[model samples]
Target: MSVTETVGQTPLEAASPFEMRVDLGKDVPETDVRSALKSGEIGFLHSFTTGSAVDGPGIRLVAWTTSCMFRCQYCHNPDTWTLSNGIPVPIEKAKEELRKYAPGLKAMHGGFTLSGGEPLMQSRFAVRLFAAAKEMGIHTAIETNGYYGDKLTDDELAYIDLVILDMKAFDPVQHKRVTGMDNAPVIEFCERLAHLKRPMWFRYVLVPGLTDVPEEMDRVAKFAASLGVVEKAEILPFHQMGRYKWERLGLDYKLAATTPPSNELVAEAVAIFRNAGLVAD
Candidate 1:
């Protein structure tokens, strides 16, 4: 299938800095955004949630965007893989939504997290939203796979306060097996973040048989340690929670019978990173 066909919409055009940039406290009419949204100049989002604690530090307003390049085997939201599957909310509407939760977020030391089907797929929108959030004095974070990390400019990234990066695997072959993508871009993204001294939380999913290998875990631990800016390493135990989504979508669900890692295994994986002198849980 063609890229557009696979995504169920044309990919966003490369946006010039002038077009992507948004000013703080400026209100743009919703009617004015139709042309941009239709042209993929803005973003198509799956949905947004308020008071989500797991996406970032403290409570957060999490925006889940649509369309991803990776077909991760463990993805719970397979329906999010296509652009047409989402609600086409313009960037201004998104900012308005964030505005509702801004005061509470700040009072609680919380923030806004842009999550996805890879938020970086709509890099321009993410950058704009983050920039606006910073203007409101709200902490901003992104939950990304890092494939499109190169899309953001230094000025745009300056608006972001933290990153929650998901590093699927340390080995190239195994990484491809899990996410159907190369790890090179992800590694490059990590290196770039390190160079920027960006604070980050590293996340890894520990599937019982698929990713529980000690040697592979060690490689991940070592890489996390080398990144100096990693504030935390989260060892997420894999679960079959999303298998139903694959079944409903009529896609073959791999790892259907693969069980979640035991609590002991989770502890061991956390220990590996802790042993490497990184804070892990």
Candidate 2:
């Protein structure tokens, strides 16, 4: 049964993206779903949370969408993998949600950011949302894996002020092992963005035994440096905050025993990016 009847078609703003949500949009007819996807009339959203400082340049109102192509082992919100787990919100409504905070956001030098479950999974919706943010004179950003970067055309891409790309791995084998997908498309997207002169910030998660390989990180640093469009590289230390999500969803948690990377490990990763002549933190 679609949870729309059991619950509500519209979702209240979530206190945090970590809150579990399920089957919120399952009641919509298949035809309607397809229409929404094609026209960008609506989007499947997990929740909207305000006052995020790390997602973009300033404090931000971040919308967490549903559906993703990558099956990353270290995913924090496994529930977001299901499209129906998100509420089917019309684009206008989503815009209104942004409008509510526009004044304060502008005053704070903040804007809007669309994050996911891979925002590009709902390509049309993602573009439309960015456009709406731009209309309101707010800065816009998207956090993506770049697997479906082609989904947005150059015109549509203009609305996005920044692209916060989460890079899993640089090596093909390691990338496949981490995301169960090849990184070729990702590299292509990054190159395209560089050619377009789009400012970018690349983030690498420092998973001790998994992604902390020195040579691989060095390659990534070099790539970012070569891009010339990468303003900064961020080395994120992996954490166990999302382990319980995997358990609750009955998925195998591969990194259950893996502790967060030590400070020394994180420093080394940062230094690799810095040595490549890209500002890293």
Candidate number with greatest TM-score? 2
Model 1 clash pairs? Answer: none
The residue pairs that clash in candidate 2, if any, are none
* CA shift of 65, model 2, Å: 0.6
Model 2, stretches more than 4 Å misplaced?
A: 1-10
Return the TM-score for candidate 2, rounded to 2 decimals: 0.96
For residues 1-281, write the lDDT of model 1, one tens digit per residue. 32223223422222210111111102324553444444444566666767778888888888877779998888877777875555566567678888888999999999999887788877878888898899899999999999889988877788889989998998999999999999999999899999999999999999887889899989988998899999999999998766766777789987899988888999999999999889999
Cα lDDT tens digits, model 2, 1-281, are 44344335455588888888877887778888888889988888899998999998989999999999889988888889988788888788788898899999999999999998989989999888888888889999999999999998988889999999999999999999999999999999999999999999999999978998999999999998999999999998999888888898899989999999999889999999999999999
In model 1, state the lDDT of residue 40: 43
**Total clashes in model 1, counting residue pairs 3 or more apart in sequence or in different chains:** 0
Which runs in model 1 stand beyond 4 Å of their true positions?
A: 1-41
